[model samples]
Target: MKIFYFTGTGNSLYVAKRIGAEVYSIPQMIKEGRYEFEDEAIGFVFPCYGFGMAKMISNYIKKSKFKSNYFFAIMTYGGKSASGLHNMEEIAAKSGIHFNYTNEIMMVDNFLPAFEMESEIKNKSSDEIEKKIVQIEKDISARKNQLIRKGVASDVLSKYVHKIADNVSKNFAYKQIKVNDSCNGCRVCEQVCPANNISVTKTPEFSHHCEACLSCIHHCPQNAMHLKSEKSKARFINPNIQLKEIINANCQVK
Candidate 1:
């Protein structure tokens, strides 16, 4: 099975790894125009952004072609994973791909401002999150035959919300360059950038097509990238993922 993933803070990557399937980053696949899958089953693993799927995933699915008998999607959300699966299923249907399984796993609440400030105190430990992932995997494997149908109310709400989310994601403004004094000009961000937006000369440069996936921001070795906001301090980084892990985990072929 081939698992295509887009991970922010490693939740989606962790889930994809646990599935023990071949994994590829959606950005890399799009860049290379490669969708050859040796396995019969195809899976998409990504984080739930803005109550739906990430724009990058939607764009990739729309542009790329895949040949697979069975399609599956696994979405990981910090808190409630509302309508994300429904939105993915809708996108698959548009592409004439039928999804055989869909699963949602709830991890730590990492959305900075959505929840209370103290909510970070309740963040699940790495071990706890791993346990939940194990259970989700077991459940998916055991119930592979069942299909969860979306209710009419859910379908309508999901479609409306997804449209709104796409608009918001497209218009969202992000800081152009986030630098700190600790930056050593390692250019690691430039190398890992899927969009190739960042180039290292005197400093990291940003161009258009910045998907705001935070791959550059989060993978900075100097811990220098910062969004221009008071809430930037609240931005949580997963200590479990180091620089090498970020590179290896971000792109995998099981």
Candidate 2:
């Protein structure tokens, strides 16, 4: 089994690692132009962004070629996953890929605009997380074949949710992230950006093509990055992951 993952603050990476697969970073895979992989089982583990998979993940799924008999996906989100799993199914359908299993796990809500990080962190218990991960690990080891269904109401909601979010995301999501004066020129943001959308000289600069994964904002040591909300929100990094792991996962081209 091989799992390809993209993470902002390492939630997805942690999940991928726990699944006992040969893990591969999505950004690294794209940068190296090595999209073709052969495995008996192929899986994607990523965070849900605005009720859907990250823009980069969708693009990667569309462009990549895979030879696998079994395919699956795991989506991690802080709040409602909404249409994220549904969106992944659609993208896979486009490429003639049918998922044998799909599911989601709720984690610390890090979308600063919607959730207060301090409160969410306190509420996200370690015991709860372990229970979920252990079950997922067992399921994957057994090659479980369950699929996630969003019920009638959720299915109806998902149809328009992603379409609306797509427009908003393309126009607004990435544009809002900005570095303040507190940025110490450490360049940690630059190194951890999975999209490689940030470049740091005196301070960090953003490219137009950011995926808005929020890795830079959450991982900035100085808490220097903020969105247009113009309010100071607490930053969050998965405590189980190291900053070195994030930097290495994203920055290393090969």
Q: Ten residues in a row with the worst lDDT in model 1?
A: 168-177
TM-score of each: 0.80, 0.93
| Number of the predicted model whose TM-score against the real structure is largest | 2
lDDT string, candidate 2, 101-165, tens digits: 89899898677778888888889887898899899888877888999987878866876777676
**Residue 191 accuracy (lDDT) in model 1:** 63
Residues 71-179 of candidate 1: C-alpha lDDT, one tens digit per residue: 7888887766667788887777887777878877777544543543245535656677777678767755554743555577876777787777666543232344568
Residue 112's C-alpha lDDT in candidate 2? 78
Supply the global lDDT for candidate 1.
0.67
